[model samples]
Target: MSKVILITGASRGFGKIWAEAFLKRGDRVVATGRNLAAIQDLVNEYGDRVLPIQLDVNDREACFAAVNVAKDHFGRIDVLINNAGYGLFGTVEETSEQEARDQMETNFFGVLWLTQAVLPVMRAQKSGHIIQVSSYLGLITVPVLGIYNASKFAVEGLTETLASEVKAFGINVSLLEPNGYATSWSGDSAFQTESMEIYNPVKEAFQQAASTPGFFGQPEATAEAILKLVDAAQPPLRLLLGAFAYPAVKAAYEERLASFEDWKEVSEAAHGTSIKTGN
Candidate 1:
């Protein structure tokens, strides 16, 4: 059976690539973006297999409306790719109030709302998959992307809870933690805060890291992995994209584990003795 997939940010990057891949494989796609024209090419090329919608996911009501529209148009939604977030480049001290809020609104709240909207639909059908496009930064923070890291971290927590809660309903949730990809994301889709003199070295380091060979994975190669995921009998709750993600995340977790072990005495001290039922 052909699956009906709903993709946000379907105009470009992985969203566009995966949307086209699904259509080419004879699946239907509800392709959405902030601008209608941005997704029109999908409609023109794939014809009835794609439904292009103009949606800004931050609007709470619009998020619900978009889900309804897709459900009404497609009859059922088998997969949802929350792929509509951007990177905010700024250190913690350099980021503005507005910049931080906007990052959460899209990267965090946007995913929350869309997931909420589709929950009922998925529950009714007893099957669906939600794929959140988080980053490896969610697990390990970068100097200049503090706010972006926070947003992905929030998504990480949210989606983990979602996975456990929705499993009984035959719904699967997955997070795509890509290390980096050669997308316009670091180009025009990115937002950079005003530079500060003190953070120049930090900013320079980030730029240099981005230019490193193998830092950014080829986005085209991810289609097979995605296809395999959605087709799996049991899809993972987290899928790390790119060759760089696993080692990076593993090292971060190892460091974190070391800290936890180091603080074991303090942590257990805080707990004190176990409470007695007789008391």
Candidate 2:
């Protein structure tokens, strides 16, 4: 069965690829971006199956309007992919408070508001999927990308809670954690303001770390994974999209475990009870 999908940030990168992939599979896609021109080719190729809409996920009214258009056009949205985000490379202190807020607004709250806009329709229909395009950095904090990482970390926790809350409504939430995919997420297109000379050392490190599009994991790879998940009888809560994603997640988990072990005694003492379970 063909699904009706609404994807934000569909102008390029993973969003763009996923829009094309779904359309190719006979799904109707309301492909949205700040600039529809970026995806003009998709509209041209897919015709009616691909509906291009101008949307800035950061804009609340625009987010709601996009959902409204999708619902009106297709009668329902089976999948909503929140793939609009960018990288803010700088230390937390080096980055201004407003910059941090902008990161959260785009990467975290942007999805939140958009999801809120779509939730009522999905709840009434009792079927839908929400895919959040996060990063390996979202799972683990990296130098110079603190603001970017913070936003993703927020998504990680927020989506975890959201999944449980909406499960009863037959709504599934999943995070797309793509390690170092060669997406526009690192280039000038995705780079945020970084004018702090104090961050010069770390800033240079991050610039070198950014991946060029189509070099690492291709956007198509992520699109394929998303399509596969869409057809699965039971989809997982988290989709680790690339090989690089797995290791980074594993390392972060291990580090968290080690840190817990190191603080076990203190934690046990603070809890006012024995924390040991004798076998």
Candidate 3:
């Protein structure tokens, strides 16, 4: 049986690629983007199988309305891919109030709003999958992308908790922590803060680090994986994509584990246990 899938940011990049992939495989797609015209081509090719809606994911009410339109049109939505977000290029100190809020609004809270909108529908039907497109930076922070890191981290926490809370309802939540992709994520789709000489070396180091061979993965390469995930009898709660994500995440987790072990005595002392915590 064909399933109905709703995807955000379907104008281009992963969203557009995944939408076409789903339509080709006989699934209905509610393809949404800020620019409605950008996705009209999908309708031109696939006709009614694709519903292109003009949507800014940050708009909470708009998110709910889009979900309703999709539910009414499709009868039921089987999967929702929250792929609408941009990278904010700035240090924690450099990120302004508005910039931080904007990053959270789209990257973090946008996921929240969409997830909230779909829960009622999924709960009533007793089945659905919510895939959140996050980044490896959510687990391992990097220089110059502080706000973006925070947003993804927030998403990780939110979606993980949602997974446990909704398991009894047959709802699955997965976080896709993709490595750096060749999509215009850092080019046109990114926002940069004002440059400061104090952080120029940090910026330089970050640039050099990102210049490693095969640092960028292709956007279309992930389409098949997503198809399998939604089709699976049991999908993972968290998934890391691309070559770079696994090793990077492994190293970050190892370092974190080492720190925790090193501070075991201090932690025990703080808990009023009889342990040596030589400060």
The pairs that clash in candidate 1 are none
TM-scores of all candidate predictions against the true structure: 0.96, 0.91, 0.97
For 1-279, candidate 3 gives per-residue lDDT tens digits of 999999999998999999999999999999999888989888999999998888988899999999999999989999999999999997788878999899999999999999999999999999999999999988999999999999999999999999999999999989999999999789998999877788989999999988998899988899999999889899998889899999989999999999999998888779875656688
Q: For model 1, how does the per-residue alpha-carbon lDDT over 1-279 read when each residue is reduced to its tens digit?
A: 899999999989999999988998999999999877878888888899999989999998999999999999989999999999998988999999999999999999999999999999999999999999999988898899999999999999999999999999999999989989998788899999988999999889988988897788899999999899888888998899999899889998999999999998889789879646774
At residue 212, give the lDDT of candidate 2: 44
Point out the higher-scoring one by lDDT: 1 or 2. 1
Task: List ranges where model 1 is wrong by over 4 Å.
Answer: 274-279
Deviation (Å) of 30 in candidate 3: 0.3
1-279 in candidate 2: lDDT tens per residue?
Answer: 899999888888888888888888789999888888889898788888888899888889988988998899888999998988888866777778788888889999999999899999899999999888887777887787788888898999999999999999999888888877767787766655656787787767766665445437766767667888888777888888777678777988999999999998888789986657788
Per-model CA lDDT versus the true structure? 0.92, 0.84, 0.93
Task: Quote the lDDT for 152 in model 3.
Answer: 95
After superposition on all CA atoms, what RMSD does each candidate show versus the true structure?
A: 1.9, 2.6, 3.2
Q: What's the true lDDT of residue 248 in model 2?
A: 72
| Candidate 2, superposed: residue stretches over 4 Å from native | 195-215, 273-279
